[model samples]
Target: MGAAVAAQAKQGGAEVLWCPEGRSTETRKRAIAAGFSEVSDIAEMARRCDVIMAICPPANAESVAGLVSAEGFRGIYVDANAVSPATMASIKAFAFRDADLLVDGSVVGSPPSTSKTTRLYLSGSGEAVAVVAGLFSGTAVDARILNGGIGKASALKLSYSSYQKASRVLAAVAHGLARDWGVQDELIDIAGGRSTSYLAEPTYIPKVAARAWRWAPEMREAAAAVGELGFPDELAEATAAVMERWAEAKDQSLGISEALELLRTDGPQTAPGPSAE
Candidate 1:
């Protein structure tokens, strides 16, 4: 995702800089391919760039904010990670002593490549938000300014992803149950006849599994968001658990049926009760 954004921004005449301090070889290769200059130091990149965009997993958002803050960066800081509103607020407080320096941002949809498929929703002081939006003006990234202040954009993102990821998990679980009941074929046939397809596709499990590890933290963040809004968070918690179960197969990309078989055979098992009670 970072590579995609960097590539687009660079293509649009922006000088993209990336810190390759602790990143993997593959990550470094991608960043270089995306036309990003390696800064080799976070503080240097922070000092050089006018606006610092933090696009990372929800779990690392706070740490990234701290890293930038420690560098004495007082420039425009955009937090585009999938985190709860409260977390966003904490990051804003941690990174920028002045609230005006933080532009709360959320990226919805896939990474921008050759097409304008991603929308970056930003909310904060109007001037700061506008400045951040201007950075991606000619790029493939579509930056939109939200009316609400900091945390609103993050709230919208978490709310949207909660349903998106949870529904995918629900579809997978439904297929698993049908397969266990010996009616998988019938379920698919029924789904085919419906307006909205009910059957999970062959690629569904594999596609989701490949990113399940990343989704786990997002799911946890979504759970926290829902809980804060006085909603039952068990659904999101269960979805996170399911994603964690498939984390081992993230790179395997097994088919839906194969993934289900693996889950039934070698995944987490229920404890046995006393024999016949």
Candidate 2:
């Protein structure tokens, strides 16, 4: 997603810079293909760019911000990770430590591309949010500046992802259960009769399986937020546990039934293919 954002910026005629230090060779190749000017390190990027965005896993949000802060990257810092509002507040504390403006941002939908674009929800200093929004103007990234302060964007991201992802998992489990009773087709037909139903899209189960590793952590983050708000977190926690059953499916392709089998048994039935994540 970080690469997708940079590629979208470059497409929008913005001069984008990326630091390949500590990143994978595949990451470097993707950045190179996006036409991002490479710098030696984060310090170099901090010295050169007006804005720095971190679009990583939810677990790494704060550590990544600490790295940027240590380098004194006082430019507009956009933390676009999927974290809870409280986690975002902790990040805000350190991010503001260096007197740097922190813009809470979140990415919803898939990675932006010509075929499909994604939404970037932004919050924090109104001016800073506008500046970050302008970075992706007219690009594949739909930068939407919200009328809120730091953490609202992340809150919205978590709320949406929690339900959307859990529903996909629920669909897989429901279908698998129905199949055991010789009623899988009836289940699909029931869902297909609805205007919008995830159960009608069993083909997406394999894709969900491929992304479960990243998603399980996200659900836990959502559970944290729910617990913080004094609500029952069993739904999120249960979804995460189910996703963990398919943790070995990270970036691995498998058939719909095979993906569901992973949810039922500890050992997954593999259909060898290339990684997707």
Candidate 3:
């Protein structure tokens, strides 16, 4: 979302600067080209920019926030990662020392570009909302401010992802079972007749599949957070476990690209033939 926000901020005549994670090609290149100064210091970026948006994974956001805090950086820290509400609260506590904390939870329907569409759900202190509300308005991006503190926005994001994740898991499980029964195509057709048409090769499926492989660690964090809230995250935990299995089975690395390629090229052990009457 740094790219989306930076591109939008540029359109709005806001000068942009960026501090990227050390290991990310996606963030490093995207931030520089969008006119953000490629500064290595998180403190410097936080000290200079009006807002510091943390778009890392939920598992990583706190470390990013800690880095900013360690630098004694001062600015609005907007965390737009996909995390549980409880985790957001912990980050909020960490942010209270020097920065104006805004806990943001964003869901991207597509890539972060002029050609792509995305959504940002903003929350946290009301004052933080007031300061950054105009940044998202009247642009190619769609950002809505939500009520509550810290975790509400993150909760919303996790819930949204959970639904999508659940669908993919169901698809995987059902597909596996159908192949075992020798009725994969017929089962898929029958399910399509009853379920939403979008389920038939969902547009989000590939992205989901790709992401599935690498989400185990993050999902573990999410599961822990969810469990802390007294909610049973069996589905999320199971999804993560299955993703690990898929990754190991393919002999590919834990990344979206590898997983996508593996799923595309790999064959099922149990092939579906004609259905038994």
Identify the leading candidate in terms of lDDT.
Answer: 2
CA displacement after TM-score superposition, residue 60 of candidate 1 (Å)? 0.5
TM-scores of the models, in the order given: 0.69, 0.70, 0.65
lDDT of 3 by residue, 155-250 (tens): 777767777777776566556545655889997788777645444444544455555656777777766655665555676687677666555443
Please report how far candidate 3 places residue 233 from its true position, in Å. 15
Which tens-of-lDDT digit does each residue in 1-72 have in candidate 1? 878876776776778899988889999889867778889699898889888888998899999999999998
Candidate 1 local distance difference test against the native = 0.79
Which of candidates 2 and 3 reaches a greater lDDT? 2
Count of backbone collisions within predicted model 2: 0
Off by over 4 Å in 3: 97-100, 194-277
Model 1: worst 10 consecutive residues (lDDT sum): 268-277
lDDT (Cα, tens digit) per residue for candidate 2, span 189-271: 88888796565688999999999999999988867765665555777788799999987899998998888888875365564
